[model samples]
Target: MRPGGSRLECCATDLRPRPPPPPSSSPQDPAIPSGPSLPPAPALRDLAGRLRRLPPSCGPVRLIGVDGHAGSGKSTFAGRLARALGGAPVLHLDDIASHEELFGWTGRLLAQVVEPLGRGETAHYRPYDWRTRRFGPPRALPPAPVILVEGVGAGRRALRPWLAALLWLELPAEQAWARGRDRDGEEQRAFWDGWVPAERRHFRDDPSRPHADLLVRPGHSVHEGYDVLPGPAGTAGQGPDSHRT
Candidate 1:
């Protein structure tokens, strides 16, 4: 989502709720590198090329999802991927989620963003103001070839049906939560305390990693920042024209 005006809220830990780690082992997508030595740039380029060629999953758009544990670096990864896609529009779930709704904003998402895009039209949704605890004016999101949905629940069951690909940021829960807490600091400590259990409950019931087509692990290399591994879904290696329900 565009980051102009008062839309900037204390988004530090909203999506960074911590949950227990899910299972690790799964069938692999042979297209991804198995070793730790794989260069990150080429992998991301390959992913971008593959995604660009994929058939649109929602209307005229190839809606890609970047979902993982809070503070797992979904936003940063999504921004880089968007750049790789030549400035594809990114819809941050933070704009759709509110203090009252949180994960309960699915209906609003469908009505405001998904449905319009599915109908080959521009979408407009009121971004929530976290500080004021109110929603602002409607912001327009045009239908781009590859639009990214980035946040904690970007790959929820309700949205998978409309995604060209779902990518999970591979990071353990405790580690990710620690990173989130450290980033947010004491100011958000109370919020994180409540968010942890809520996030746990959400993930325990509706997990995203299991359904992901690609698993992205943060790379230690400063230049090449991420390694895109095969996810449990095993569909990552398929041709761009392939489909997944």
Candidate 2:
């Protein structure tokens, strides 16, 4: 087990015009092929607007937390949400985590990213080079209207108080791990062996789902986007205990 609360601080297009567009069909239409959902454009736009309007949880930034299992599509989902938020900045936890300290980079993150942002200043953090086992050059993260922190443990207890909203990708653990393993392939097989158990322990003690403001589920296809629903926390930006089990 690793230490917790280590200190510190905190779109696309298409083109091709071959045939006329199909008749408008309600999303509920069963006959509709689950292929072009595209992150529920209208919903995402509304969410973006809401997030922008929210009071900044950090100094001048609405720090949104996107938490989920290792391979539950947090990165992809955050990328789409960022575009919907008009190019909002996103901080991937992967850049902060390393082989030896997989879930123990909180101190580095707080000092490098959160503290500066909390002070209404630019934050610079060195991204970890997994291949080299060392941190890289610093990258700056300005205080934006909305900034997404995406990865596992993003909504952990220590960071929840600083989040404007916490979103959890709803997916079964076994399935998510399987996808992660497959994505990493044989080269990272040993890594996965160590990671799976660590992740399980992390979630077991500091679960994020019960405190999520929204629950996101990927659609049937890559193009199908995602389906966002009220999470166990009920209304977005509300109290964490509002719907905790």
Candidate 3:
């Protein structure tokens, strides 16, 4: 199942055409209010510590997933969470996805990353270069004690089975998408034009919210820290208990 192997031919055929992008519309406020105030930094740190102690779901790695809309601060949050976990490795889905195969990376991820890590070996996969529209050289990922998979669909059904915990950023789609578009700027507008719709369709078909172990919302304080609440999928009993302020 390794990359550059026979599996790739079948994987390529599994790629589906991108759906038409959704119609443009004004951004709307989230229907639900941001969850209760976040616990203090000490509590968050405690949660991270506990996660670091969890039994590895993949080989010797406790694979955590940070999933949310494109602009829902997933990368920033994952970075902070990684630091809290004492420098866990992070795998960005952006590197696995290409312009032509937005959500068609499950096979590649499994073959190049997950399977190897599951076997207690270092995983190497070619990262896609969006600017060049071609995959670059292979990147090495060590099978650390804790690893984070962050991106829009990190919690998809295909990946959940391998994750120790799935944390969903509780931001509304419209607002998140707006933030993403704004962050990328006018130059990437056309790309966003197509991305918006594809994202919408992907979520519609395989929503991740209901499967999240924790619903993470920004903190009410000036620093805008973050709050982690119990989600429909329920906590895995390894992190801090759900706290509401």
Off by over 4 Å in 3: 1-40, 219-222, 235-245
For 1-245, candidate 1 gives per-residue lDDT tens digits of 11111111100010111222112211101122123443235445556777787778789998888898886777767766676577789888877887667678899999999999999999999987667778899999999999999888898888888887788888888877887777666666776787778788889888999977777776443333555555677432433332111
Clashes by residue pair, model 2 = 9-110, 10-114
Candidate models: Cα lDDT each: 0.68, 0.69, 0.68
TM-score of each: 0.79, 0.79, 0.79
User: In candidate 2, what are the lDDT values of residues 56-160, reduced to their tens digit?
Assistant: 787888889989887777776677678778788889787888777888888888899988999999999998766677889999998988999988899988788
Residues 223-245 of candidate 3: C-alpha lDDT, one tens digit per residue? 54455676677623334444532
Position 108, candidate 2: lDDT: 88
State candidate 1's TM-score: 0.79
Candidate 1 overall Cα lDDT vs. reference? 0.68
RMSD for each of the candidates: 11.7, 10.7, 11.1
